[model samples]
Target: MNALVPLPVLLPLCATGLSLAFGTRLKQFQRFISVAVLTAVLGLSVALMIAADMNGPLSVHLGDFAPPLGITLVADRLSGLMLTVSSAVTLCVLVYSLGQGMADRDEETPVAVFHPAYLILVAGVSCTFLAGDLVNLYVGFEIMLVASFVLLTLGGTGPRIRAGSTYVIISLFSSMLFLTAIAMTYAATGTANFAQLAGRLAELPLGVQTLIQGMLLTVFAIKAAVFPLAAWLPDSYPTAPAPVTAVFAGLLTKVGVYCMLRTETLLFPGNRLGDLLMAAALASMVVGILGAVAQTDLKRLLSFTLISHIGYMVFGIGLATREAYGGAIVYVVHHITVQTTLFLVAGLIERRGGTTELTRLGGIAKAAPVLAVLFFVPAMNLAGIPPLSGFIGKLGLMRAGVADGSVWAWILVIGSTATSLLTLYVMAKVWNLAFWRAAPPGQAADGTVLESDDDSDDDTDEGPDRMPGTGDEGVRPRHEPAGRAVAATLHGHAVTTTTRLPRLMTWATAATVALGLAYTVFAGPLTAYTDRSAAELIARVPYVEAVLGR
Candidate 1:
């Protein structure tokens, strides 16, 4: 089982080279390589999860070198669980992207580049989960970010390039901070390995420990998009292609949260900054949802909610107890599935309705009932409706908060509850506007715009000079009328709206939706697993021994 630790990281990387070698010359084979590799990874991850749960942590030393010198990978129960969930989500999203490429005549995803980039992204994510030292973790992040930049600017369209630029800048800044943190850690403690840091950091002076912890937390916080640092997300995500946005939303920020969970528990056992974490959680919950409430675009709306719900996991972490950690882990798993499913469904809605702008969408319930159901289940799940996995996770966290009985905990309980209500309201608004309301005038019941209304341009927020569909970078003619602008927009919408929702895409989304429901069905055993994982993480002994053989 120890040998299995490196396979998840290695398989995708090897497959990546094969994918690139095939390139556009063998598109089908490239797609096959990606799907098969991810499928293998998912299987391996599940096996690792069970093995780690039953047998403690699993560790592998590359080049036969021991820890503190050679690179090491460890898969404890928490990392194993994350690996399983992330691999499953990535595989589903890959299938969805393939379907998208086929539907678009290979225009959207560009199979050649997308396959290798996505494989690299998957390998990077797996590496981070399995990394035993700070330096390996940094390498993993760099690999992931580089691939993400490629994915984000796939078409080289003006909007995508702009959004990708913002994303790249923020990501690079965070990477610099991460490097500084690693350097400081090694300088102070003589080793950057987690197990070594566990014993050594505790011996440092109080001020030095505080400075290092604060710096590391800042770096992870920026990656995680906690409030005050999250302004880049909504702007960066909505412009990408659907599958790119979906996978990023599902896995990336959670990587940051995972790092926080690992470091806080293993390296800073006492939670010296518990109150500070709680305060950030409170602000994230409140500010993030408020931003969501103001969004009219579906993707941007989901982006804000993503930041808001992250607060729930952080809330659990701030409590710093076994039960709290268990709850946080459960919420992380649930959020990853539900959030990815919602974004995929959002893509479907965009395909059917022609745009993500709610004002222009309507009657989807009547036009395409299956899409409606697909959107509704996950949307409700996201809102924490009863009996769903979302509710189960939130309830666990709240219960843990109450048990803590601290004043900050009480405040978080109130804040989280309010955030849940706001989330429900936001989902409901989207449903009413996009799925339930009568189709806009000149738009048919099927969501096709038969003719452009002269006044339609007035309803939109885009200015005449910045018409929505004009991809050219230059300014529009000064004399262009608003009605003419509206006509051009209709033409652009027709191209997307007329596309038949491909069978493969629909099936992939349904598969993801089913995965979210599976969590609800298996809540008991899942919570039990997370509880045990939390115990091991808090104890930190199993992982240390597994890596150092001490």
Candidate 2:
């Protein structure tokens, strides 16, 4: 039983190693390995969740070493829930990537690098969730950063390189901050084990505690892309290939949020930065949604909304109640599936329409109703439409805020509601422009918008200015190149030359949508589990005892 605890992290690392060892020769086998490994990890996660629920926070001391010294991997309710959700999400994304890889078989960015790097990324996420010490957690974060840098720059497009550079520099800066905090922590307490830190951090002076807390939260904030720190995300994420962007948007930022939850509840239970967190949450929601509202490109719009929704999680953290934390947990799981599905759908949109620009995309509803539905389901879920997981999660958070009954919480309540409304409006706008409208002027029957069309000047003259940074020096416009497609329009569809979206990609995306819906179906049990998880997090003693064996 104890042996199973490390498998989630170990399996991915082994998969990555095998992928690397095989290199390009076994590329086909690597895909099968990726799926099998992630599926196995998902089963293990489900087992972990059940076992943790039954026995309370099962743990393993690596190499038979004990607490505050040896490596540890624990799957309490919180970590188990995260592992399960993340495993499910990563598996969906892995299938999506396989579809992408198979479809564009000869596309730049070696397939050999993709499987190993992606598996390593999964390992990092699993390690981050399972780590029982701050140092191990830091290692996980670094592993993720390194893998992400490769994934981000995969195609080596000029824009991808520039965007990847920004992402790497930001990741490194945040990492330095995290490492500095770890140093301060170890120097202050002489131990890095989470259980030990929980007991010892309080022994430091109030000022010292606050200082350390501020530094650590700032580091996480950068990783999480909370408010001011979020400016880098919208530009950076959209440049990657569809599958990479989807996984990064869904999983990476949440890892930071995960760490924040651990630090706020376990190590620094007082939550000295409550007001700061609340303020940042409000700022992120309002600012991010507003940015989304202005974006005319599908990917950029989603990227902005990603930043906005992080505010919701941070808001729940600010409230610091069990209900609020549970709500955040629920929201995190829902968002992971829903957001990833949307980006995968975006890939389909780009493939079929030859672009994701609102001005350039059209006739998706007519050309591929499946694409429209795939995009619509998750868009509605993301906007918090009723009877969906998004609604359930948001309702939980709103109720928690009301139950807290603080003036600031109420203010955030209002902010949350407004953000939801704006989110809906944004999705509706996307529906209108991308699915409902006729093809853009000069759109060829093959879905290619003629770049040099006589009406091209008319487009700029007629519509709002293109986004400022969107057209900056290095960035490629969201529209893919208009390859040599014969030009003609018929019956309101401009995409006569549309490439068929890969069936594998579509099915993978559809399955993810189903996964998001499943959260609504299983909300009762999931929420109950989260409630228990939040209680364990807040109580902290069981975790300590589980680790200390006292």
Candidate 3:
């Protein structure tokens, strides 16, 4: 009878259907509807969290059919907490995108269509978090993949199209692998319900159980962008528009990590795979940060850092103790907020400076002092500065690692520290290049070239500058006609250019910065909640009982 409670999932689903039906002709209406739907969903998710906290775990079967025969949406402490955080993040990103005028950019003009796809993506994520069965989780994954495919390609640029292709291919392959894993799980246990599988899986032969665990890990690793399968992430993430990049960075990969945490902790506990996971995690941290240091583009550098930080969470998972898992949970929440804020600030820098390429930009702090602070806080936080949420999270994780006392755990601890230092270096590189260097001669106030001038002799070369007339002329400059300059000066005067954040965009950046600060100040309460959620997840029995009515 619990099936009656469907609005939390259904609200977003209905919004998606509405947008698809009337998105183009009534663009404003679509935006209004999308925001309204998501706001309601956010409230519902919060209520769900409060309810779960009050009442242990809650489950609602679909179609009035019992689990093992039908689908179910289960909300325990972990899923409930995840849903609340994810909904809040998505809502903020949606508002930020609107404020940034993303919907109006020619590239995202069809972003009228984006409302529908975005809602569907949120729905999919919710479903994934709430799913009680492996098959249902697979369906949730497919839903998100399909929606993300459209979001990734929204701008229709050559790079976006190319990136979209890679994203889709990787996603589809992962889905197929997930499906295969689900088939194996069902075959082994005769039921896809998570609780049922957990009980049955524990009784299976050790060899068969390991095989199942390997398959599931492979599928989730691809999703989480863990080492050796993480190439698709940096290439694909940087190509999207800012808000989309923010949400994708904030929420998507973490879903994979969530799946991994649940699988290892619940369905296949006591497997002694901690050493293998620790090795993979160490590689992810070192390699990802190294890649970050080598990147000159702001977005690309952040993408590398994102992959690197995923290692810290995985490291916590590998430790497999209550304290370690608690740290991992806190890190997950902290990373989501901090990462999204960083990306959004980077977008603001791009909009104000006219490019994200470090070589082409300089001295933006003079023009956008507020923007400088906005970028600096989270950059430092991501680098694990004291008093910030990032440092608190890393400290928690390192403490847990030391407590575990395994050699591999110690290796992870050292690697994570090194990764944090490298992260600071990369962030500093961006700060110095983008906000500290003097503006180049003949550059506009925002460090952009005001006009193309073949003969100015004032184009300050920063990184790899391209010289004009490199063909047969061979380093010789071609003379511009005297008359051309006079005519161009007259025509160019009418074009007005400015370099400051719009009021709305300024507020959007401020809001995200505020979010980071809030996380920092409220770390104690948040960590306490995360610890409770971790405990519930490890216990597993209440989650099972709620879903199966046993």
After aligning candidate 2 to the native by TM-score, how far in Å is the CA of 288 from where it should be?
0.3
lDDT of 1 by residue, 1-550 (tens): 7888999999999999998887668777888899999999999999999999999999988998878898989999999999999999999999998877776565323456788999999999999999999999999999999999988877565666788799999999999999999999999988989998999999999999999999888888888888878889988887777888898999998998999999999999999999999999989999999999998888889999999998999998899999899999999999999999988888787777666777767778877899999999999999999989999999999999999999999999999999999999999999999989865543322223332322243334222232123232434232222121111121121213443577888999999999999999999999999999999999999989988886
- Candidate 2, residues 386-502: lDDT per residue as tens digits? 999999989999999999998999999999999999999999999999898765653333323434212332333222322222232332232434421211110111222345778
Report how far residue 41 has shifted in candidate 3, in Å. 1.5
Rank ordering of all candidates by lDDT, starting from the highest: 1, 2, 3
lDDT of 2 at 330: 92
Each candidate structure's TM-score, on Cα atoms with residue i matched to residue i, is 0.91, 0.91, 0.89
Ten-residue stretch with the least lDDT total in model 2 = 484-493
- Model 1's number of clashes is 0
TM-score, model 2 to reference: 0.91
Candidate 2 contains a number of clashing pairs equal to 4
**Candidate 3 C-alpha lDDT tens digits along 402-476:** 998889988899999999999999999999998887644323333333333233536554322222222222221
Supply every candidate's count of residue pairs whose N, Cα or C atoms clash at under 3 angstroms: 0, 4, 0
* Model 1 weakest 10-residue run by lDDT: 482-491
For candidate 1, list the clashing residue pairs, or say none.
none
